[model samples]
Target: MSTAAAELRSQRFAAAVPDLERIEAMPLLAEIDALKRARNAVVLAHNYQAPAIYHGVADFTGDSLALAQQAARSEADVIVVAGVQFMAETAKLLNPTRMVLISSLAAGCSLAESISAADVRALRRRHPGVPVVSYVNTSAAVKAESDICCTSANALRIVESLGVPKVIFLPDRYLGHHVQQ
Candidate 1:
């Protein structure tokens, strides 16, 4: 990493430390506790989520997959994921019997949008019978419509594991381009 970027990150850490200490000494957490009980819901937040939302509201927090896995294991009737649409869809895909809600559908992800089911189907037509390996960052409708799901960290493994000569990866042109290389 560049020194500038490293310095900027260090500055961010320095800026956040004082506020974190203050929050730790406050009664805000108590209020959030009451809200959680009243809502009868559990928040599975992403690491990228705002500190107030992540630390204040989230009962379980982690990366996209980790939070989704937690949601699947949680007993809460209402699961509110303070992340993007794909993350929420992942929760729905896992816990199909439960209710899942995204804090903001507009909070989109480039990787998730890289491919759609329709795009996959269209590509399939072009390739005749080649398999389509979609990233888990897709809608359930897209997932249900897919051959299988994989993550960015596991994209190549899924490709090699599937043993398909032709592959059509979607929605995120960037992720697709990255995987192709």
Candidate 2:
């Protein structure tokens, strides 16, 4: 590494020293690591997670879609999601055969909460042949009810690809509206 890069790395480590010290003071970080090894699990944390969880225990940390993609591609027997419930569900959706666990069941996202599986089912019943597209922010159950799943970045193409004049897009009204436009 260049001298400047080395100095920057040192500075970054120095800045994180306090947080690292706190993590080291407890057995949580060590236990989590040990558990990962024992269970052959890969922990995927979102960018919004706590620094300790993100920097300390997470094997991969990124956005929801990125984390889900990583979890889908991971060779581990188990996957741990250190974000909201929907994120864990997303991982499970992608890796249906793998064991997916959430760091905390209490963690939730407002967008995910906006729709439920029953609601999607009801929409399908009403629409009959119209395709249902679910945003990735939704729960796995919701995704299962839909014809396809899409991310914010690919919402337009996903919607258009269905080749339907009218399709149901759930959870995020704004995104659905954008796709409609």
Candidate 3:
């Protein structure tokens, strides 16, 4: 094996290799890449992924929020998120016009569990025309209704982007306070 492959194999994971190998598609990774290029889709993987899946992606890598923005700006007509559910949702939220698919639908976020569109609607009703700035950890339904989205890394910038002196931050309260700070 090459040195990089060896290093990846040595890394620890919660699932056993045999468990993943029963219907392994690693063999088709090259073919999948070729197919994606033919179809003009960009594949995104996250920073926390298993090395095999991470390295096999087509175009880019980052934290969930960054990958979402990448999907939004991509020239490709389709986006395949080789990551988790929340990541896929974020991508779809940003790329509402583009086709977005997930490698696995079971992946999710408990923090993302914190808010809903009804909540945003109610909040917007109370605030009344105040801009809603949703954290990127939210569901696409929530994001679709938001005026703008922000990552922890860029929350302040996003808030400032609205050119408004005040905004309502959502889903991740700590991120709200962090950005306010």
- Give, for candidate 2, the lowest lDDT window spanning 10 residues: 1-10
Best by lDDT: 2
Runs of candidate 3 with Cα error greater than 4 angstroms are 1-26, 93-97, 126-130, 160-166
- Considering summed lDDT, which 10 consecutive residues are worst modelled in model 3? 9-18
Clashes of each: 7, 0, 0
Q: Whole-model lDDT for model 3 versus the true structure?
A: 0.75
Which one wins by TM-score: 1 or 2? 2
Q: What's the TM for model 2?
A: 0.84
Report the Cα lDDT for candidate 1.
Answer: 0.74
Error of model 3, residue 155, in angstroms? 2.2
Identify the superior model by lDDT, candidate 1 or candidate 2.
2
**Per-model C-alpha RMSD:** 7.8, 4.3, 5.4
Estimate, for each residue in 65-148, the C-alpha lDDT of model 1 and write its tens digit. 798779878887788899999899888878888888888979988766766668777777888777777777787767866787
